[model samples]
Target: MTDIPLEHVHVAPDDGADSEPAPAVFVLHGRGADEEDLLPVAAELPDELHVVSLRAPDPLQGGYTWYELDLSAGGLESSQPDAEDFRRSLDLIVESVDAAVDAYGLDADRIGLLGFSQGAITSLSLLLEEPDRYAWVVALHGYLAASYASLDPDGIESKPVFVGAGAGDRVIPESRTTAAVDRLEDVGADVASGSFPGGHGIGPQELEAVVEFVAARAV
Candidate 1:
């Protein structure tokens, strides 16, 4: 129903900023997942904020993938191509977000990005590449893609970043998450990292931390 295509349908909360200028949250899903996967998490956020869940452009065997993958690669190598594809998709999404902000009379400085797995990689990439784009960034169960080393730290505007990962994540090692947190911090981002007891998925504590981060930034 939103202006984006059916594949990009965003399940959002009804409430948003009461003032003419509102804050917005863009939700990106994990690999093999659709936009709907994070819609429920939006409900846990402050009701006064607008939430938009974006779908990946590439369709996988059954679900979806942000970009191609090569299993032969080690660590972050397997995610390089997909990360690049997500960067390209982000260009279009940022334009869409600009249009949405204008249409809803939302504050541009209040926009935020929330992502999981591959989506988290995209979110962090965007933040590092375009530091001023979002007020805050939330990355769950993902690490910084290899391409992150090329980013210029001075370009970042010191925005708040929330990195949450599981201690038992088999897909994404906890070491990778810690390395990412260190990278973002070194790049002048005010980052907060948390670890959950579960596997490679969101837990209640992580969700609560994210909600708190978004709510604090929305004010």
Candidate 2:
């Protein structure tokens, strides 16, 4: 079996115990950020969830990246991931999550995902690849990759997905975010999307909305 190489930070549920398994939300940060970058956001999440924030395996700009980005189709610095690296990273995450279930005694059926920017791209991609695997998802300021654009969605049910993007974001661009939302909805995923005013970062309203979104569904 391959090794799970991603580093992580796990926050136990507030009213949880070792004997009783709790639901979990695995968090993935944006490019150039680490496991701890999403701690504050994790703190604001529902207390019933055991939050596990993972560091991307590859390093970039003194931080971490899920995989090397492919800019060959260059137009405004497209953030499409290098296909092979992306696959490897996805395997790492899957292994790491399976291990977390064994190690932390988390509820496998209630696994959720949250991410921003490049991390969002990964999260959304994972959701598309395995619709029934995740209970819910939140992808911020990230778009769908062209790789999994044609997945068979007949197996997907009413999976809840919350998508947030800054109207002024230029890095990944708002249009890319909208495209992601459209794709998710097209695949029969229940998507809640909002375009806020900002640039490449989450605003107060976005945070509040995300917190509420998770709370309503936390197991």
Candidate 3:
């Protein structure tokens, strides 16, 4: 059995660079989804990226989840992640991505992260908790978890980040996404953020922006 922490789909670069170790992008799916959900996004990325889409550990309602929701605050818009599960998922992803650097012959310094919904929340968490590990980040329809409310910004200076949210998002309100963007900027990260016209999903325009932002920096 493989030692990688999470279930994953790895797509090698279509037009690989003329080098031994390839750059990589880790794709994390939204809650109630599996590793396969975001493969199409990977296809649109630079051909030089070794894309790896991850499956969250906990299975839920015929799908998967990064962590259980803590909706004690009333509804989906006010929900938070269960702390224990969130931390565990973050640890597993960190381990898996680190291992992948060796297992897949990836360039460690060129690693990127992309996620949606719950996955997006986790992506932001990862970027904050271990900012030096990731070279770039794209988080969609997600917010900064409460646990990282006071992260030190010294390590992630000028880190590149892309955040997306739907103007009509009921699942994860655009306000939350904006808060995440604001925090990233406060921490001195170079962030590019936008709002779409749909509800809790990646529209074409947002998708194009994600593609462009990553393509420019991932190179």
Candidate 4:
């Protein structure tokens, strides 16, 4: 399970140094999306970033999802995310990150995480549980899972984060979105955020902010 299916995008170093370790970003796609879904976003990011996108372990309807969502009550809820599956997926992500660092000779301290929807939830969960492994995070159109509500501030305080959502997103209600941001801020994460005037997906303005967020953290 640790050997996650991956698609790699190598960006050439501008300095022309053969051995200089370039910064890296692990791109996580939304529910029912594949590894290729976020590759374009990676391309728009700063050049020379080693991008590693992973496919979710569980196969869903026609694509992939990180975890199972129980919306039996007609509300967007994930109070139960297949605990065993989540553990396995989370473990694989950590293992993959470490392996990627070793194989590419990349600086672990410079690695950032970018994700959307379910991907975003996993990214935030991983960061909250294991903050030392990543430098920053960009979580789009997602909320903090109920399981991770009691995150310890000591482990993640001062961590850089960019959390964005759509004002018209019906899938994740505004209340949940607001709570997600408030949770992160209460935990002392350096949170920079924006809301787009759209639905349950990312938009141009959000992408622009993402670019700026990545650039600022890349330094």
Candidate 3, which segments miss by more than 4 Å at Cα? 16-19
Q: Residue 212 of model 2: what lDDT?
A: 92
For candidate 2, lDDT tens digit of each residue in 1-219?
224467899889987655787899999999899999989998999888999898999889999989887888886447589999999988988888888888888899999999998889889888888777788999999998899777756546688999999989989898989988887778788889999989999889999999999999877
Clashing pairs in 1: none
Better of 2 and 3 by TM-score: 3
TM, every model: 0.88, 0.95, 0.97, 0.90
Which tens-of-lDDT digit does each residue in 43-75 have in candidate 4? Answer: 888876777888887788787888877665455
Mind giving the per-residue lDDT tens digits that candidate 1 earns over 1-219?
A: 345432554433455324566677888888888988888887788876777777777788667777776455766434465556656677767766776776556678888889998888878888887787788889998888777855765557467999998999888878888889988887788888899889989989888888888788765
lDDT of residue 29 for candidate 2 = 96
In model 3, the clashing pairs are: none
Alpha-carbon lDDT, every model: 0.77, 0.87, 0.91, 0.80
Q: Give the distance in Å from residue 161's predicted Cα in candidate 3 to where it truly belongs.
A: 0.3
Candidate 3 structure quality by residue, lDDT tens digits, 56-157: 999998889999999898998999999999989999999999888888889999999999999899999999988889999999999999888668656788
Residue-level error in angstroms, candidate 1, position 92: 2.7
Q: Return the number of clashes found in candidate 4.
A: 0
Q: What's model 1's lDDT at 106? A: 63
For model 3 the local lDDT of residue 149 reads 61
Question: Which model, 2 or 4, shows the larger lDDT?
Answer: 2
